[model samples]
Target: MTATAVAASVPVARGYRFELVKLWSQRRVRLLLLTCWAGPALFVAAVSQQSTLPVDTLFGRWMHATGWAGPLVTLGFAGTWALPLLTSVVAGDVFAAEDRLGTWRHLLLAVRSPRRIFAAKVLASLTVIMLLVAGLAAGSTAGGLLTVGNHPLVGLDGHPLAPADAAGTVLLAWICVLAPTLALAAIGLLGSVALGRSPMGLLLPVLVALGLQLAQMMPLPVPVRVALPGYAFIAWNGLFTSPAQLGPLLIGITVSLVWAVTAAGLAYRIFLRRDFTDQAYDGAGRRALTSGLLPLAGVLVVTIAVIVPVTGGPSSGIEQDKVQRSVATAFAHLYRLQTEQLHRPAVTEVQLDTSAACTRGGGRLEPQGPGNDWRCVVSWHLPGVPAAGSATYQLDLTPDGRFMADGDGPKEVNGYFLVRTPAGDAPNPLWQFDGTVALLPTVPKG
Candidate 1:
C-alpha cells in the first residue's frame, strides 16, 4: 500500500466536540474531576468550623464556610500544589494515554493524520484543564463570598483594598498564578506523547516544578528568577497586600508561555515522526527536541544572560531607609513608655529622690506633644555632693507665680509636660510641673 493511499483511507475528525466527549467519558478523567471539587469543599468546611480566623477584623466574617471561604483560601490551597497536579492529570494522559493503551495507531488511522490526532488530543486536554481551573475559581470565589462576604479585602502587603478592585486583582493574580501550571501542562502533554507513559507526563513536570522551585528560592540572579515557570506561583505573596503587583506576575506569565510552547512543539514533532510499531513501549523515549522550539530555548537563555549583569546591584556601602524608620518607631515607643513610667507621682508625700532627664535618645527624634511639652526621662543619679544634712525647709511662691526655691534644694524645678488647649486652639504647655521639690500638702515622710 502506498503511503498516500494509507493516509487517504483515514477519516478526518468532524470537530473537537466529538473528541471532547470521548475524552470526558474516561473513568480516570471523571474521577479526577470529582476529586477536585470534593477536596476543596471538604477543606473549606473543616477549616471554617475549626478556624479562629480573625472573623472580626472589620471585614465581615464568612457567611458560610464553603462559599466565601474557598477563594480566600485558594491562594494557599491550589497555588502551591493543587493547580499544577490538577493540570497534570489530563496533560500527562492526553496523548500518552492512547499510546499506553496501544490505541495511537487506531487514532491516527481514524483521523488520517498525526497532526489532526495531536490537535484533537491537545484540544481535549486543554478543554479539561480550562474547565477544572474554572471550576476551582468559581467554587472558591463563591465559597469565599458566601462565607466572608464582599467586604474590603485586606491584602498580603498589609494594605486594605476595596473588594470591587480587589476582586479584579485577585482574579488576575490567580490566573497569572495558573500560568506556571498551564505551562507545565503543555510540557506534560508532550511527555505523554513522547514517552507513552501517563505517569511520566504528570510526574516529570512536577519534579521539574519542584526543581525550579528550589532554584527559584535560592539567591540567583534577578533575570534567572524572572525566567522560571515557578515564579508565577510566588504571586500568592501579593494576595495579602496591594497596589496589586502586576510587574512580576506579567513576566511570570510570559516565561510560563514560552516553556509551555517549547514543550508542546517538541511533543508535536516527535509524535508526527516517531514510529511506534515494534518500538519499545517502555524505557526508551523521544531522543530529540523539535526544531521549532529551539528559538524559544535560545531566547530564554540569551535573555537571562543579558539581564543578570545590568540589574545586579553594584558592590558598595549603603544605608536602607526601612531600617531607619523601624529604629525611629522603636524610639517613639520607648520614649513614651519611659517618660510615663519614670516620673514619680506625689500624693502629699515626704521628700522624694529625683533624677535628671535627657531630652532625647540616640536616634534623631522630633518632640511629639504640644509646645515645649517634649519632656524626656533619663536614669540620673546626682553624685559627688553629700545629702544636704537632712535640712528641714519651707517653700513659698512669689507674686509673679514663681514657686520660690526657699526650701533646701531650691523650691520648684520646672520640667516639660503635655497640655492641650480647647478645640481649634493653638498648642500650649500649661504649668510646667516640677519633677523635684514636691509641694507636699502638709504631709511628711511618715
Candidate 2:
C-alpha cells in the first residue's frame, strides 16, 4: 500500500494495537510484570520466617495474625516509591523509545495524526499500568494467605475484621491507589514526550514523586498537602478504620484527577506541535527540554499562588480533636481485646466512655497539629472500679494524619513490650499502635 493510502486508512484503534504489540514484545515490560507478581510472594515468605516484623509499616505488626495484613503492608511500602517507579518504567519510555530509534517520523507518517498516535500510546501505557497494579495486589494477597493463613485482621481502629471482610477491604484499598498511580503515569508520559530521552523520561516522574513526599513532610497548609498527588497514596489508610473516613479518600481522588488531566493535556498539546522532520531532530534536545519544563514550572507557580492565598494556615491536618477521637476509639476497642484475653467480662467502646486530653511539647505548644512530642492522657471508666483509669501515650505524628503512639502505662497491663496471651507472648495491641485521623474536617456527632 502507498504511504498516503496507509496513513488515510489507519485508525486510532489500529495505532493502539500497534503500541500494545510493541509493549508486549519488550523484555522489560514482561520482566516488570513477572517481578510484580513474584516479588511480594518472596518478600512475604521471607518475612514470615524472620524473628522480627516490619512494625514501622501500617498493618505490619499484624502480618502474622492475618493473611490480609500482607497486602496492606505491601501497599504502604509500595506507595513510598515502588508504584511510581513501576509505572514510570513503561509510561516514561513508551514515547522516548520512538525518538531513540528515530521511528517517530515513520510512525507519524503511517498514523497520519500525532493526536491519534498520542492517544494510542497513552491508552496502551495506562492499560499496562493497571495490569501491573492488579498483579501486585493479587500476588501480595496470595502470598499472605499461603504463608500466614486466613486469620482475623486487626484493623487500624483496633477492631477485628473477619477474613472475608478483610479480603474485600484489602482489595478496595488497592483500588483506591489507582487514581494517584495513573496520575504519576501521566506525569511520566509528559516527561517521555518532553525530554525525548528514555533515561530522563523514566527518572523524572520518580524524582517528582520523591519531591512531593518530602513536601508532605514539611508543614505545608492542610489544603495544599491534601491537594498533592503523593497524599493519595496514603489516603487508603482511612479504609482500614471502623466507620471508614471517606473524606481523605474523596479528596485524594479529586486531586489525582486534576493532576492527571493537567499533565496529560499538556503532554498532548506538546506532542501535537512537535516537528518530526529528520533535520528538526538534530538540535531539538535543548529546545524540547526548555519548552517542556517552562510550561510545567509556570503551571506549578500559578497553582501554588492560588492555593497558598486561600489556605495559608500552618495546621498539619493532624488536628488535636481528630487525633484524640481516633486514639480514644482505638484504645477502647483494643482494651476490650486485652480484657477478653484476660478472660474478663466483655466491654464496649460506648460503655468505656473514653476521652483523651492531648498536648505537644509538654503543653509548651498547642495540642493540635503534627509533631513528634505529642502526648495524650487517656481516661476511661471501668464497670466495677470506682476510680477512672488513666494511661499516658507518646505519639509521633506525620503531616498526613498517621501517628504511632506508645503507651506509658502499668507494666502488668501494657506488659513491657509484649502482652501476655494464651498463645504465649505476642506484640501488644495497646503498648504501641498506629492510627490515622481523617485529615479533612468532619462534622461533630450530635
Candidate 3:
C-alpha cells in the first residue's frame, strides 16, 4: 500500500498493539514493575521490625497500633519520590527511545499519524502506572494485615472504624492518589517527547516535582498554591481527618486531570511537527542535545536571574518594619492563648500592647531575609500587674512568613507556652500545651 493510503487508514488498534509489544518486550520494564510491587512489602517489614514509629507523619503514631496504618504511612512516603520515579521510567522513555534507536523516521511512515502513536504510548504508560499504584496499595494492605494485628483504625477524625470500614477508606485514599500519579506520568511523557532523550525525559520530571514542592514553601497566595499539582498530591492527607473533607480531594483530581491532558496534548503536537528525516541531527547525540537543550537552559537561566532580583529586592524582601509588625501580631496571638491556658479573663489583642523592640544579636536591627535570628525585648501587662513587665525572646523567621521564637522570660521558658498553629490561627489546642513554646509579652491597654 502507498504511504498516502496507509496514512488514510490510520490503524489505531495496530498502533496500540505495537506500543504494548514495545513496552512488554523490554526486560527492564519487568524489573521496574517488580521493584515497585515489592517496595511496599519491604517497607512494611522494616517498619514492623523497628521498635518505634516515625511519628512525624499523619499515621505514623498509630502505625504500631494497627495494621491499617501501614497503607497510610506507605502512601505518605511513596508519594514523595517512588511513584514519580516508577511512572517516569516508562513514560520518560516511550517516545525518546524511538529517537535514540533511530526508528522515528521509519515509524513515522508506518504509523500514519503521530497523534495515534502518541495516544497509544500514553495508554500503555498509564496502564503500567495503574498497575504500579495497585501493586503498592495491595502490597501495603496485605503486608500490614499480616505483620500487625488487624485491629480497628483510629482515623484522624478521632473516630474508630471496624476493619472492613478502614479497608474501604484505605482504598479510597489509594484511588485519590491515582490521578496525581497519572498526571506525573503525563508530565514525564511530555518531557521525554520534548527533550527527545531518555536521560532528560527521566530526570526532568523528577526535577519538576521537586521544584513544585519547593514552590509550596514559598509565600505564594493560597489559591495559587492550591492550584499546583503538588498541592493535589499532598491534599490526600485530608481524607484521614474526621469528617473526611472531599472538596480538596475532588479539586486535586480535577487539577491533575487537566494538567495531564494538557501536557500530553502539547507533546503530541510537538511530535507531529518535528521532522524525522534528518539523519545527521537524529543520529548524532551531541547535536541533538546542543540544538534542543542549550537554548532552553539559557532561557531558564535568564528567567531565574530576572525573578530573583524582583522578588528578592528590598521592596519585596523581609524587612525590619515587617518583622516588628509580624512579631507583634504573632506575640499578641501567643499571649492570648497563654492567658486562656492560665484561666485568666480573655483580653482583646488590641488591649495588649504587643510593641516589640527587635534587634539582631547585640547590634541594631538590620533589614534581612528569612532564616535570620534575632533578639527582642517585649513589654506587656500581666493580669493584675501594676507595672509593665519585659521579657527577652530569641526569634527565627522563615521566608514563608512563618517564625519560631524561644522565650527567655521568667519561669515561662521551661514550661508549656503557645506557638503559632499550622493554619496561622491562635489558641490552637493541639500546640497549646507544648512546654517548649515561647511567650509573647503584651502590655495592658491604658
Per-residue lDDT of 233 in model 2: 90
Order the numbered candidates by TM-score, best leading: 2, 3, 1
Model 2, range 1-446, lDDT digits (tens) per residue?
21122336468899899999999999989999898899988888678667889989998888877778889888987888789898789898888888888897688668877778888999999989888888889888888999999998988888889999998899888988888898888889888887775487878789989988898788777767776777779888888888888777877776777778878887887777677764235323676556666755665565555555434444566777888898898898898888887667898888899888898999899777788999988899998889998888989988778899888886765536777777687667788888887766676554
Alpha carbon lDDT of residue 2, candidate 2? 19
The lDDT for every candidate, in the order shown, is: 0.50, 0.81, 0.64
Which predicted model would earn the best TM-score?
2
- The regions of model 1 sitting more than 4 angstroms off are 1-15, 52-69, 239-241, 279-300, 309-446
Q: What local lDDT does model 3 show for residue 298?
A: 51
- Per-model clash counts, in order, read 24, 0, 5
Model 1 lDDT at residue 51: 36
* Error of model 3, residue 146, in angstroms: 1.0
Segments of candidate 3 deviating more than 4 angstroms: 1-10, 281-446
Better of 1 and 3 by TM-score: 3
User: Which one is best on lDDT?
Assistant: 2
Instruction: TM-score for candidate 1, please give it.
Output: 0.63
Reference-based TM-score, model 2: 0.92
